[model samples]
Target: MIGNMEIFLIILAALILFGPDRLPKIARELGRAIREFRNSLEEDLAG
Candidate 1:
């Protein structure tokens, strides 16, 4: 399980690597992709 310190370090690394301004947009797109992927998997399983 990831602890608070690990989460903070990951966020800090992302901020440094991607720049703070682009992080939110990146996160949003990542979330949408994950959601769509999960939905497709669920549909496949259901069918």
Candidate 2:
């Protein structure tokens, strides 16, 4: 399991890599992709 410090460091790395402007857009896209993937998985299980 990841701890708080690890998560902080990952966020810091992301900030440094992507800069401030594009991070939120990238994060939102990632979230949507994850949600879609999870929904597909549930559909497959139900069917």
Highest TM-score scorer: 2
Regions of candidate 2 where Cα sits further than 4 Å from its true position:
none
Return the top candidate by lDDT: 1
List where candidate 1 sits over 4 angstroms from the true fold. Answer: none
Q: Model-by-model lDDT, in order? A: 0.99, 0.97
lDDT tens per residue, model 1, 1-47: 99999999999999999998999999999999999999999999999
lDDT of 1 at 36: 100
Model 2 TM-score (2 dp) = 0.91
